[model samples]
Every structure is written in C-alpha cells, then in structure tokens.
Target: MTTPFSSLEDYIALPRVESLALSPDGRKAVLTVATLSTDRTSFDRALWEIEADGEGVPRRLTRSAKGESGAAFTGSGDVLFVSGRADASAAEAPDAPQLWLLPSRGGEARCLTRLAGGVSSIAATALDGETVVISADLLPSSRSIEEDAAARKRRTDASITAVFHESYPVRYWDHDLGPGVPHLLALETPGGDELPEVRDSVETGRSADESRGVYPSHLTSPRDLTPTPRRSADTAGQALTPDGRTLIASLRVAEKRSGRFVLVAIDVASGERTSLFDEPGVHVESPVISRDGRRLAFLRAPFHTADAPADQEIWVADIDGGDARRIATDWDRWPSSLVFDRDGTNIIATADHDGRGPIFRLPLDGSAPEQLTTDDFAYTHVAVDASSGDLVALRSSWTRPPHPVRVRADGEVFLLATPAGAPAPLGSITEVATTADDGARVRGWLLLPDGASAETPAPLLLWIHGGPLNSWNAWSWRWNPQLALAKGYAVLLPDPALSTGYGLDFIARGWNAWGAAPYTDLLAITDEAVRRDDIDEDRTAAMGGSFGGYMANWVAGHTDRFRAIVSHASLWALDQFIGTTDNSEFWQTVFTPRGLTENSPHHFVRDIVTPLLVVHGDRDYRVPVGESLRLWSELAEHHADDDGTTPHRFLLFPDENHWVLKPQHAVVWYETVFAFLDQHVHDRAWSRPAQLG
Candidate 1:
C-alpha cells in the first residue's frame, strides 16, 4: 500500500522548484530547487541541470554548505551562478553572495568577483559569455571595491549598528534598507593571464580611521554603471541587449508625495545614460529587450489612487525610445513575465484569467490576445529558445508544486522533472461561477475532498487570497489547500473584485471601498459553492492572510455564517495601518480619510459573533504585529462578559515574517487552525495543539 501524505511534516519538506533558465543553444536547462535545510529553519537553494529533450534524468550541478542560485548561461555555454562560499583567495565575507562560473564542458566551479556588499543579480550577453553585468551594494562614500571594503571594516571595528534615512521608506516588506546602496557594475572576464582595467567612477572619500586594501588581480576591473547617489535601479528585472552594448533598467525616481519608476537605457562602453520612457505620474517596470535589439517591451501601471487603480498595461517601443505603442489596449488582464517569441512579431506572456494563470500569445500587429493554455495550472519564468521555437516554464497548480515543463506548439505540456515523493491523494477541483448583486460575473475554484458525496457532504472552508490585488491562480506552499482537503473539508478559492485577470473596471469596483464590492463578490461565489451537493453549507469556516485577513475580519463582523474565522497579519484599523505600514506613503495616496473610517474592520468589532483565531509574525513589516495585538485586545474586552464558551485564540511567531516560513511553525499553524474549527464548527470540545504545550 502507498504511504499517505502528511500535511505539516511531509508538505513542508518537499523540494520546491522556483525558476528555469534555458541554454543559448537550447540543449540544456537549469532549474533552481529550494529544499529544507538540515535544521529546518530555512531553505537552501542549488542549481540542477536537465536535458531539454526530456530524455535524460536531472543531475545536480553545484553543491556547497551555503548553496548556489541565480543560474544563467553565457554565450560560450558556460554556466554562471551566485553563491556565498568562502575561498582562501577571496575576502572572507561568508554572508555576501558572490559570482561563480562553471565550465559548460565540465569542470570545478571557480569564484569570479569579491565585493564588500555582495552581488544581488546578474545579466550576461549571448554574443560573448565573458561580457557580464552585476548589481551589488556599495557605500555612498566609497568609489571603488577597495574603498568599499575599507569602509566596511571601519564600521565593523567601531561596532555601529544604526541606519540613517532621508526618504519615505526605510524598510521594505521584510528587511531594512540602507548602510549601502545598490549599484550596477560592468566587467569582462580576463583572457589568458592578462588583467583587465578596473576604473573607479567616483573619488574615494574615506575617514582617517578607515583601513586600506588592494584589489584582487584574478578578477576584472568593474566600472560603476549607475552613478546616481540616491536613485537605485531594480536589478532583478534588469535586461541586457543581445550584443551586450546596452543595459535597460527600471529606476526608482523620488517625488514629494509618492515615488515613480522610469525605464532608462545605459551605454555599456561610454558609461552614458538616456531616459527611454518616463511618464509624469505612472510607474514602468519589467523591461525585456528583444533578441534583435530593435524593440523593447515593458509593463506600465498608474500610481495607486482612488481615481487610478493599479492596472498594468504592456507597451512596446524602439530601442532609442521612439515609436511607442500600447499593445492589447482592449485586453482585460494584465500581462507578466513578458518575452519575445522566436519571431519578433509576437509576445508570449502570462496573466491571471478566470481562476488560473495561463500563458497568452499577443501579436504586435494590434490583434486580440489568444489564450494558449487551458488548464488550471499557473506558469512562471517562461523562457523561449531562440534557435528553436520550443517554450519552457515552471508550472504549478492547487495539487502540484512548481515543476519544470515544456510547452509544444500544439499546446501540449510535458513534465521535465519527476519529484521524489508523492503528495496524498487530492480532491477534484472544478470551476464555479456566479453573479454578484450588481450583475457582475465572478468565478472561483471548488475543491471537493476524496469520497465526498451528497450522502456524506464535506464542510466548506472559504480561503481568501492576499494581495487584494492578487488572484488565487497559483499554488502556494504556505497556504496549500491540500492541508484543508486532507482534514475532510471542501475548499473554495475565490477571486472577487480588485483581483487581477479581470479588467480594470473590476478592480475599480473595490478601489478605496474594500469592504463593498470585494466582500459581496466573495459572498456570492461562496454562496454558489456551498450550493453544491458535495459541500455542507451549514458547517462552514473562513480564513485569510494579509488583505484576505482583512476580509476575514470583515466577514466576522458582517455575518455569522461561518462558525470560526482565521485572520493572519490582517488590517484592523485602516487609519492606523495606513500610517504604520512599511509603504505608508503609497497607501496614503490610495486611501482617503473617509474610506479608512468606512472600511476599517476594527470599527465594527462589536458586531462579531463567531469565534476567531488570530495569527501574526513580529517581523512582518508590510502588516505590522500591532494590528493583530489591537484586534485581540478589542475582542477580549468585548468577550469579558461572556462565559468561556467562545474559545478565541491567538498564535504568534517571533522569528517569522509576513508568512510562516519555518517548517515547525507551519505545522503548528495548521494544527491550531483545525483545532479551532473542530470546536466551533463541529461542536467538539476544544483541544489545544500538542506542539503548543
């Protein structure tokens, strides 16, 4: 007999494949697989290679205690990756990730560059593998690599641990910014024993206490490509031209009220820059240069506001920023992961549609977009082999984790890698649709557990997705529906108003009115789902995180339909959340005082009748821990008169961030959730999770 899949232990231990990169010749492909570390406190990533033909078994490429990731192929077929491994010839900064190169034919990997702040991302040209560009952190006062190292040593010796900020945002979603700013560097590999020239773009301004050091001779000299002091470019989405002559990047431009992003093109040889595209109040990002170096494609969206909702549109322009046109202007969905087809006549991209993320083919000739894939699976990191028209992507679904797959011209998909273990049997997933009170069409995914039928119906669990802007189109390890299915519950995944894949009007329906259209649309879809014979409507629960958590809190106040509610890192008082969130300026532009007062869940806390389970992480900067604390305190005050029958609970993780990442914490999260449901929904005695004791 086959072993059954375990929810917390087995699911958290599964090897997750995140991204895929195809070789220039299209013969080899590299996949970045992240697995649980030995301590199970974090994930370790490594590069794995497989044949694009789907014949040979997958083989591990690089291994180290620190692990390797960000794999890319050079024009000469060599594999270049990033790691933090310590080497005797290099400076001993084990925390800093550096570049490493592995020979295409086969050889031991060698370290390339050693920077003080470490490398964040890299891009290489297909014309020559040796020509490369990297994004690294550098102190604003340091001009060269040696100066940066000296400044770092001085700071460490003084034991100073404070960051000074002059901007609106000091911290992002999880971590603090500053101490060093992001800078782009251009370098070429040394040929034969000849050392390349390294130029320091700015003068070194170190204090008298700073140490001095010499640059390594094995690496080529790097030139500072981004010379601006306070303006940092997004290197993760940066793209390089085929000839390696130009670099395209999205730069963050600071403004008085809110910031805007603009696309800029840099000359690799002359160190000159030109603004390719810049709109007054809009943000542009995700630039992809065509293989021929003739055209550039990017996504543009307005800055968040009540008047302009965040709906992204794809735009095409000449390499010199001329003849720009917005393609698929009439299309409803916003496209992502944009890439040029083998021919420059079309673009291949992924977008949220219905309840899934499917790839779409958009023609440059001004025609409507055509959906390529029909299944419920979501695709990401799409890559097309220029030599052949073959396409490859990382596909994932509600039941399946992300895996590398090949898409044929006829829309057939073939799995490229077979994971080691199998998950427990999953229920059947079907698409359900309904009309809201305003006659708007909404859709959702209904997961029916195994052996569920009309005679023995399964309890319903409404799982709301975060993003408020993001739809439930992809598989998420942190909030997998399989755990709920294994507990004999039917899961309902709904995409209400403000969810992408639908048009801008759908998003506008909930703009600054979060508690209005989105709530009713969710309710309408859940109403349709519970009507199914296999779902038990009388016994139901609701749960969500982030924006979904906000909705769960709203559900508790608005209706007593659910027996229990689980809200994770949710927004309690909108006024307080908008002022304290990491990106408060961005939210300030989107919400008004009236909207905050009208939509806040904390205002209606006195109406809550169902039991609630609040979960939060102290490290979550996006949705701070104070939101949950205030919620718990208010709920406690309201329930002081009642007996001990309600059984409301709170779960807190000190080390975690917005999401529960550690393996042990994830197990506890699920256990506590199910236990709370069993007590209120099933009318059973409250049993605390054994691990909590």
Candidate 2:
C-alpha cells in the first residue's frame, strides 16, 4: 500500500487541521482545516464543527471557494469568521476578507462588514455576543469609510504603488506597511435576532440598505475604537472582558529609533483609553483575561542588549492593572502563549521545554509551573471549557500535522475526530543531545527512516531551525523532515545555542557571537548524530532557512564536512542584512558593529569548498533578496571557474515572501533542494526542475 508520506504529490494533498476554537458553552468546537483546492495551486481553508465532549463525528460548518479562517465563537454560540467569499444577496460582494457570521440557531452565513480594505481580523466578542470588535485598515488621514474608499480609489486611478513612510519599519515580513494603518473597530450584532438600523452617518457614511444586503436594517454601524491610531494597533494582541465593557490590548509605542509594546485598556463604549502596563525597554503582550474578567495574565519581555538576552516573564495582575506581579520566575522555559484556567487560580500556558512544547499550569501562589500532558507533541490555540474545565487545543509533532485534541483537567489528552484526518506515519523520532566545549547542553530531534539500521545505514541531512531563538519542538509543514525520512534520509533537527527550550544562559552564550557558539553547537550535535550506527557520516548535507540559512552559510565556510549546503532566505553578510532587514532598528541596537563584521559568513566565503544552493523569495522583506544576490555574486567572483560556471545554484521565487507559500512553489522548493543534495551528497547528476523551465 502506498502512503502519502512516500509521494510528494500525495503528501501535499493531505488535509490539514491547523487551529481550534471552542464555544463558551463548551458543547461544541470549531476547527480550521486546510485542504488543497481543486486547482492544486493553493490551499483553501474551511471551518468544521465537532462535539466538544468527543461524542460525535466532525461536521462541516461552512464552505466557499475563498474559504474561511479566524474562526471564533460568539458568547451565544454563533460562529464568527473572516472570509472573502462573495455574498449572493449583496449587489457587489467583497473582494477582500470580511467578517461573517454563522448563526447558532442554524442558517446560512451572512456578511457583517464590507470595509473597502476588508476586515483585518476579528478582535474579540462580547460575553452575550452582541458587541464585537474587529481590526480593519483605515487611511491615517481619512475621517470616515467613504473618505478612505475615495483615497484608495484615487491611488488606484493614479496607479501609484508607492508607500510613504514616517516610521522605522516601512515594510513587514513580506509586505509593505501601507497607506493605511490598522485600527480597532467595535460593532454591535443582534445574535440570533435581527439587527437595528445603522446610526452615525460618519460611521457608515451611506444608506446601509444600498451598501449592505439582507440584514442591513438590523446591523449597526461599526464604530472606530482607535480613531487616532498611528500603527500602534498593527498586529496588536487584544482580549475583551467577559462583560465586553473594556478591551485589553498590546499597542506598539514607537520610540526614537525602535518601539516597545505596552498594555492598554480601552473602554469599548466610550472609546476611552487607559495606560495599563508601560515600562521602558520592556514589552507587554499576549494579554489574556480570566473567565470572570477579574484578573489578567500576560507576557512581559525586556529588550535584549548586545551583551545579554532577556527572558519572557509571565505576569499576573488585577483587571485594572493593579498589584501586578511576575509568576513562574524560577522556571527556565519561556512561554509562547497563555490563558487563565477555568478556576482563575492557575494560568494554563504552553512553553518550549527541553525539546518539546508542553502545557504548564502556573499557580498564582507562585510555587512552580507544573508540567502537564507528558508527550512528544506541541500544543497551540488552547481553549479552556468553563463548564467541564477540560482543555481543547491543536497538537502536532513530527509524526503528525496539527489535529484537534481534548485535554482533561488532570492531564489526559484525547484526540478528537477530525474530518481532515491524519497523515500516514513515516518515521521514528528520537531525542539527541551533546555537551558543548563550554559544558553547556545542546539538544535536538533526530528523525530516522523506516529501514534505518546498523546494517543499512542512511544518509544524513543536518537541518537547522530558522529562529536562532527557535527550538525544533513542533511540526512544520514548510520544512517537514518526514519528507526527508520518506526519501530514505536521516534528518538531524538540532536546537543549538540561542534556542529557546534551554535556559537564558544558553541563549546568552551566543548573544553577540552568532558564528561561534551556534556554529560549534550545530557541529557538536551533528557529530553526535553521525556517530550513531544507523547514520552514514560520509554522506551528509546541511540545510536551513532564515537564521538557520545563515548558519548553513556559516557551516559551509567553517567546514567541508558536509558534502552539500542549502541556504534559504539566509544572511550571508551580517552588516548588509542588519541594515536592509525590515526591523533594522531593533537589530542595530541588539548587536555591536564589531560583532556583526566578525561573525559575518560573507567574509569567509573564499574558504567554502562544498557545493552550495541558495534559495530566496524576492518579496522576502525580512531577509530580502539582496542577501542571496550578494552571496551568489560573491560566490561567482571568488569561486567561479574561468568558463563562468560554478558548483552552485540559486532558486528565486518572485511572488513568494519570506517563505515559499504557494503549493506549487513549495513543491519546487523541495524538488530543487532534494536534487541539489542528491547531486552533491549521493554523487548524482543535477536535474533541473521542469517547472523552472
């Protein structure tokens, strides 16, 4: 029997469930499932509903060509989501994503907002589900939706694609910041009943019935909550109190050259704002309100300097920002996301620990964080059931993509039946670790092929993780080692120096010296992996993306042990990267100029002997295409033969961003990478991908 794991085409076609949303009543849950579209060029997402108690099979809730995402349940159990699907009732359907509602009493979904720029995201829903807050893009100078639309049309008519910037970061990871800034807007919904006529001419700026179809008479106008926002609400983390009277959010406060996020509470009705937790050199984000809306649990991270990196501390405080104190102070792991437990006495959070992301229960009394659900999987989108106190989250690992699961209060985890299903088991994963020369511990996950054994050793692929700060703890669709395992290669996913799962000290070891400890740590872990009986040390290659790509470049110059090296969206030259990257100000402040030059891989390019493959997307504003272009140019300048040829390759995706997102592009990315590895490591002929031709 052939499994999807053995074939790239089959693997890409498998249905994937990525996020989970639980109803307030805890009777049902909704999941966001991604499946390959009929065209196979893109993945379309849809919402699915399942029994929260695990009693019934999952049922499809909503479907459309454009698909639905950002699924959240209103207090009344009505599902609210963002979709760009056209509405038959409207004269002209929205082309951009708009807020939609799926009534709890069972009816067809309805369009809720038709902003010209579309709804950025659904922020929060009131307890009764009447008041809803959404994030939308508005022109900084526009006073109303009509004016914003007019301004946008004017730009389109003039064919002006340029963005005027007054801020430090003009672009984000993959796109320009904009002619418009994100603002929080609050609106009122009628739940299962009909909405009232829209008021406030400035809010809607038109006859509601003419613009909005069907329920125009029932829907109220969306009120601008952050009227004078200056990009402060861009990608802000917000939570609405159970009473829906106030909204707690993390707004970016722009500094001279950098910015720090501070917590703020906004009165939903009056649009009044209050500073909650503001501290210099520190960021307060990921705010979560208690079930009773009495307390707040959020993450506090101080800015890192060139000398040292700071830890992210979990802080608990009163709803009004009084008597705030940090909890889990002694814990070494850094939490990524958190939520208040049903009882409000403990905070349920997920953090990278050792080599896995596990859920931890941090008591308010501050004894220690209790580890829950001992497993090899990482969890996200965790929601606590107020009635049963059970947890529902999306969990995944190397063996599986994200799937919905229910976690009991006592720590038992049960897989919920998902319509998306699971992929075929491909490889066995084991933990690998080694001690650095400095006596510090380094660890990673090693994925082994099915036939890997002492008698039948497998070639090794030493894959590095991107976030110099990230650990290889969760399942990654973009860089799945399971595909490599299926291709009969043993993959070494190392969490070297600067990885999060380890203590702050481990990160500080590589603080300003990126090429030193991190590079050596990768080598140490690789050395340990290649020593295993089922690994062939002679046939090995190194590959990474982003920061990992930088390390790949570093490894290529520092050692010829790996037969081939692949770097994607990498930093070949440190100084060039720091200045060109979107968040230059932050990087400039974090690393000294001397440190950037000393650790730069470009300086040592003349020493690289291994075959190199550089992959980058032109739209990658984070790393930028210039990094790869310079690396390629330098490789040619120093290593190219007189015939104008070299043992190197560059794969560029003009439409892609920091990552190769489109399905076809992703396939080509893997094909090119695999071909490069086979050509150099296995001594096979280079095969050009047909798609490129």
Q: Which candidate should be chosen as best, given lDDT against the real structure? A: 2
TM-score between candidate 2 and the true structure: 0.96
Please give each candidate's TM-score: 0.94, 0.96
Q: Go through the candidates in order and give each one's C-alpha lDDT.
A: 0.81, 0.87
Model 1's C-alpha root-mean-square deviation from the true structure amounts to 3.9
Runs with alpha carbons beyond 4 Å of true place in candidate 2: 195-218
lDDT of 1 by residue, 1-693 (tens): 122334567667888887788887777889888888899877788899988878788899988888988888777778888898775443243358898778886767877777877888775444444677888888778878788887887888899767777666777787777778878888765322323333332334322212235656546668788864564654436677887778887878878634788898889888798998789878888888777889989988877776658667899999888999999888888876899887777889998877788988889999998888898899998888777787888888887778788887667888786433336548788899998888788988888888899999999999999998889988888888888888788899999998987788888889999999999998889889888888899999999999999999999999998999999999998888887888887777788778878999998989998889999999999999999999999998887456644457899999888998788898898889889998888898989999899
- In model 1, the Cα lDDT at residue 224 comes to 82
Q: After superposition, how far is residue 124 of candidate 2 from its true place, in Å?
A: 1.6
**lDDT of candidate 1?**
0.81
lDDT of 2 at 20: 90
Q: Cα RMSD for candidate 2? A: 2.7
